[model samples]
Target: MPSQSAVGSIETKGFPGVLAAADAMVKAGRVTLVGYIRVGSARFNVNIRGSVSEVKTAMAAGIAAVEKTEGATLESWVIIPRPHENVDTILPIHYTPESEIYRQRVEGGGAPLQSLPGNS
Candidate 1:
Protein backbone atom coordinates (compact mmCIF):
# COMPACT_ATOMS: atom_id res chain seq x y z
CA MET A 1 0.00 0.00 0.00
CA PRO A 2 3.03 2.29 -0.40
CA SER A 3 1.85 3.95 -3.60
CA GLN A 4 -1.57 4.19 -2.01
CA SER A 5 -0.10 5.49 1.21
CA ALA A 6 -0.72 9.13 0.55
CA VAL A 7 -3.27 9.14 -2.25
CA GLY A 8 -4.36 12.00 -0.04
CA SER A 9 -6.42 12.98 2.96
CA ILE A 10 -10.19 13.42 3.09
CA GLU A 11 -12.22 15.73 5.34
CA THR A 12 -15.98 15.83 6.08
CA LYS A 13 -18.34 18.06 8.00
CA GLY A 14 -21.44 17.01 9.96
CA PHE A 15 -22.19 15.74 13.45
CA PRO A 16 -23.40 12.38 14.73
CA GLY A 17 -24.05 11.16 11.21
CA VAL A 18 -20.48 11.92 10.26
CA LEU A 19 -19.44 10.28 13.46
CA ALA A 20 -21.50 7.22 12.56
CA ALA A 21 -19.93 7.08 9.11
CA ALA A 22 -16.48 7.04 10.64
CA ASP A 23 -17.73 4.34 12.94
CA ALA A 24 -18.92 2.27 9.99
CA MET A 25 -15.54 2.55 8.27
CA VAL A 26 -13.83 1.34 11.37
CA LYS A 27 -16.32 -1.45 11.81
CA ALA A 28 -15.99 -2.48 8.18
CA GLY A 29 -12.21 -2.36 8.27
CA ARG A 30 -12.15 0.10 5.40
CA VAL A 31 -10.00 2.80 6.98
CA THR A 32 -8.40 3.93 10.18
CA LEU A 33 -8.22 7.34 11.74
CA VAL A 34 -4.68 8.58 11.49
CA GLY A 35 -5.39 11.30 14.03
CA TYR A 36 -8.13 13.07 15.88
CA ILE A 37 -11.08 14.39 13.85
CA ARG A 38 -11.57 18.09 14.50
CA VAL A 39 -14.95 18.41 16.24
CA GLY A 40 -16.98 21.62 16.04
CA SER A 41 -20.44 22.90 15.24
CA ALA A 42 -19.97 24.90 12.03
CA ARG A 43 -17.50 22.33 10.70
CA PHE A 44 -15.54 19.18 11.45
CA ASN A 45 -12.68 17.27 9.82
CA VAL A 46 -11.95 13.57 10.02
CA ASN A 47 -8.65 12.10 8.78
CA ILE A 48 -8.72 8.61 7.34
CA ARG A 49 -6.27 6.18 5.70
CA GLY A 50 -6.77 2.97 3.73
CA SER A 51 -6.79 1.59 0.19
CA VAL A 52 -7.39 4.34 -2.40
CA SER A 53 -10.72 3.05 -3.61
CA GLU A 54 -12.11 2.43 -0.17
CA VAL A 55 -10.81 5.74 1.09
CA LYS A 56 -12.46 7.75 -1.63
CA THR A 57 -15.60 5.69 -1.63
CA ALA A 58 -16.09 5.80 2.10
CA MET A 59 -15.38 9.51 2.17
CA ALA A 60 -17.91 10.30 -0.53
CA ALA A 61 -20.59 8.02 0.84
CA GLY A 62 -20.00 9.15 4.37
CA ILE A 63 -20.05 12.86 3.57
CA ALA A 64 -23.18 12.46 1.53
CA ALA A 65 -24.87 10.52 4.26
CA VAL A 66 -23.88 13.08 6.86
CA GLU A 67 -25.04 15.99 4.73
CA LYS A 68 -28.44 14.39 4.48
CA THR A 69 -28.71 14.36 8.24
CA GLU A 70 -30.31 17.26 10.06
CA GLY A 71 -28.16 20.24 11.07
CA ALA A 72 -25.29 19.48 8.72
CA THR A 73 -23.67 21.35 5.86
CA LEU A 74 -21.19 20.12 3.33
CA GLU A 75 -18.11 22.30 3.27
CA SER A 76 -14.98 21.96 1.14
CA TRP A 77 -12.76 18.96 0.57
CA VAL A 78 -9.44 18.13 -1.13
CA ILE A 79 -7.08 15.20 -1.72
CA ILE A 80 -3.94 16.67 -0.23
CA PRO A 81 -1.27 14.15 0.80
CA ARG A 82 -0.21 13.62 4.33
CA PRO A 83 3.04 15.26 5.37
CA HIS A 84 6.15 13.09 5.18
CA GLU A 85 4.62 9.85 3.94
CA ASN A 86 7.95 8.19 3.07
CA VAL A 87 10.45 10.51 4.66
CA ASP A 88 9.91 9.00 8.10
CA THR A 89 9.73 12.17 10.12
CA ILE A 90 8.69 13.16 13.59
CA LEU A 91 5.79 15.46 14.38
CA PRO A 92 7.22 18.70 15.72
CA ILE A 93 4.11 20.79 15.63
CA HIS A 94 0.41 20.56 16.33
CA TYR A 95 -1.82 20.99 13.27
CA THR A 96 -5.13 21.64 15.01
CA PRO A 97 -5.99 25.06 16.36
CA GLU A 98 -7.96 25.37 19.57
CA SER A 99 -8.65 29.06 19.03
CA GLU A 100 -9.75 28.87 15.45
CA ILE A 101 -12.75 30.95 14.39
CA TYR A 102 -14.75 27.81 13.70
CA ARG A 103 -14.15 26.59 17.23
CA GLN A 104 -15.12 29.94 18.67
CA ARG A 105 -18.37 30.04 16.74
CA VAL A 106 -19.21 26.49 17.80
CA GLU A 107 -18.55 27.17 21.46
CA GLY A 108 -21.21 27.72 24.18
CA GLY A 109 -22.85 24.35 23.39
CA GLY A 110 -25.35 25.50 20.76
CA ALA A 111 -25.38 24.69 17.06
CA PRO A 112 -23.04 26.88 15.05
CA LEU A 113 -24.57 29.81 13.23
CA GLN A 114 -25.11 29.78 9.51
CA SER A 115 -24.16 32.72 7.31
CA LEU A 116 -26.91 35.32 7.09
CA PRO A 117 -28.89 35.70 3.87
CA GLY A 118 -26.96 37.61 1.18
CA ASN A 119 -23.75 37.36 3.18
CA SER A 120 -22.35 34.60 1.02
Candidate 2:
Protein backbone atom coordinates (compact mmCIF):
# COMPACT_ATOMS: atom_id res chain seq x y z
CA MET A 1 0.00 0.00 0.00
CA PRO A 2 1.10 3.55 -0.59
CA SER A 3 2.50 5.23 2.48
CA GLN A 4 0.07 7.26 4.56
CA SER A 5 2.54 10.10 4.95
CA ALA A 6 2.43 13.41 3.13
CA VAL A 7 5.30 15.04 1.26
CA GLY A 8 6.04 18.72 0.93
CA SER A 9 8.55 20.90 -0.86
CA ILE A 10 9.34 24.56 -0.38
CA GLU A 11 11.48 26.32 -2.95
CA THR A 12 13.53 29.42 -2.28
CA LYS A 13 15.71 31.55 -4.51
CA GLY A 14 18.86 31.26 -2.39
CA PHE A 15 20.70 28.76 -0.23
CA PRO A 16 20.41 30.81 2.95
CA GLY A 17 16.67 31.06 2.51
CA VAL A 18 16.29 27.36 1.92
CA LEU A 19 18.44 26.52 4.91
CA ALA A 20 16.38 28.79 7.10
CA ALA A 21 13.23 27.15 5.83
CA ALA A 22 14.56 23.67 6.51
CA ASP A 23 15.50 24.51 10.07
CA ALA A 24 12.17 26.08 10.79
CA MET A 25 10.21 23.36 9.04
CA VAL A 26 11.65 20.55 11.12
CA LYS A 27 11.42 22.49 14.34
CA ALA A 28 7.82 23.57 13.87
CA GLY A 29 6.44 20.14 13.11
CA ARG A 30 7.00 16.42 13.47
CA VAL A 31 8.21 16.19 9.91
CA THR A 32 11.39 14.80 8.51
CA LEU A 33 13.75 16.92 6.45
CA VAL A 34 13.93 14.48 3.56
CA GLY A 35 16.52 16.25 1.43
CA TYR A 36 17.55 19.40 -0.33
CA ILE A 37 17.49 19.86 -4.09
CA ARG A 38 19.48 22.43 -6.03
CA VAL A 39 17.44 23.60 -8.98
CA GLY A 40 20.19 25.66 -10.58
CA SER A 41 20.26 29.47 -10.73
CA ALA A 42 20.65 29.72 -6.94
CA ARG A 43 17.25 28.14 -6.35
CA PHE A 44 16.89 25.36 -3.80
CA ASN A 45 14.14 23.08 -2.55
CA VAL A 46 13.67 21.73 0.93
CA ASN A 47 11.71 18.46 1.02
CA ILE A 48 9.79 17.16 4.03
CA ARG A 49 7.57 14.18 4.86
CA GLY A 50 5.15 13.38 7.64
CA SER A 51 1.44 13.25 8.42
CA VAL A 52 -0.78 15.60 6.44
CA SER A 53 -1.27 17.94 9.35
CA GLU A 54 2.40 17.90 10.23
CA VAL A 55 3.44 18.58 6.64
CA LYS A 56 1.07 21.50 6.48
CA THR A 57 2.43 22.93 9.71
CA ALA A 58 6.01 22.55 8.55
CA MET A 59 5.27 24.16 5.21
CA ALA A 60 3.73 27.14 6.89
CA ALA A 61 6.70 27.64 9.18
CA GLY A 62 9.16 27.10 6.34
CA ILE A 63 7.46 29.61 4.09
CA ALA A 64 7.48 32.18 6.86
CA ALA A 65 11.18 31.68 7.44
CA VAL A 66 11.94 32.10 3.76
CA GLU A 67 9.96 35.28 3.71
CA LYS A 68 12.05 36.70 6.57
CA THR A 69 15.42 35.73 5.12
CA GLU A 70 17.28 38.46 3.25
CA GLY A 71 17.52 38.01 -0.53
CA ALA A 72 15.44 34.86 -0.47
CA THR A 73 12.42 34.65 -2.72
CA LEU A 74 9.64 32.11 -2.27
CA GLU A 75 9.57 30.41 -5.62
CA SER A 76 6.97 27.65 -5.37
CA TRP A 77 5.76 24.83 -3.16
CA VAL A 78 3.56 21.72 -3.06
CA ILE A 79 2.24 19.28 -0.53
CA ILE A 80 1.04 15.85 -1.62
CA PRO A 81 -1.09 13.95 0.83
CA ARG A 82 -0.53 10.22 0.63
CA PRO A 83 1.62 10.36 -2.45
CA HIS A 84 1.77 7.38 -4.79
CA GLU A 85 4.26 4.65 -4.11
CA ASN A 86 5.89 5.33 -7.45
CA VAL A 87 6.43 8.92 -6.50
CA ASP A 88 8.04 7.91 -3.23
CA THR A 89 10.26 5.41 -5.00
CA ILE A 90 11.33 7.79 -7.75
CA LEU A 91 11.49 10.98 -5.73
CA PRO A 92 13.96 11.78 -2.96
CA ILE A 93 11.14 12.19 -0.46
CA HIS A 94 11.44 8.80 1.15
CA TYR A 95 13.10 8.66 4.54
CA THR A 96 16.42 6.90 4.95
CA PRO A 97 17.25 4.59 7.84
CA GLU A 98 19.02 7.43 9.59
CA SER A 99 16.07 9.75 9.17
CA GLU A 100 13.68 7.06 10.38
CA ILE A 101 15.19 7.43 13.81
CA TYR A 102 14.28 11.06 13.77
CA ARG A 103 10.78 10.30 12.55
CA GLN A 104 10.31 7.80 15.36
CA ARG A 105 11.59 10.21 17.93
CA VAL A 106 9.20 12.88 16.78
CA GLU A 107 6.28 10.51 16.56
CA GLY A 108 7.04 9.28 20.04
CA GLY A 109 7.31 12.81 21.30
CA GLY A 110 10.93 12.37 22.28
CA ALA A 111 13.31 15.25 22.45
CA PRO A 112 15.08 16.11 19.21
CA LEU A 113 18.45 15.57 20.85
CA GLN A 114 19.48 13.87 24.03
CA SER A 115 21.61 15.76 26.48
CA LEU A 116 24.61 13.99 27.89
CA PRO A 117 25.00 14.15 31.63
CA GLY A 118 27.93 16.14 33.02
CA ASN A 119 29.10 17.01 29.51
CA SER A 120 29.56 20.66 30.43
The candidate that achieves the highest TM-score relative to the unseen native structure = 2
Residues 68-88, candidate 2: write the lDDT tens digits: 999999999999999988888
Ten-residue stretch with the least lDDT total in model 2:
111-120
Global lDDT for candidate 1?
0.48
- In candidate 1 the C-alpha lDDT for residue 37 amounts to 51
The 10 consecutive residues of candidate 1 with the worst lDDT sum are: 91-100
TM-score of 1: 0.51
lDDT for model 2, on a 0 to 1 scale? 0.87
Per-model TM-score on C-alpha atoms:
0.51, 0.87
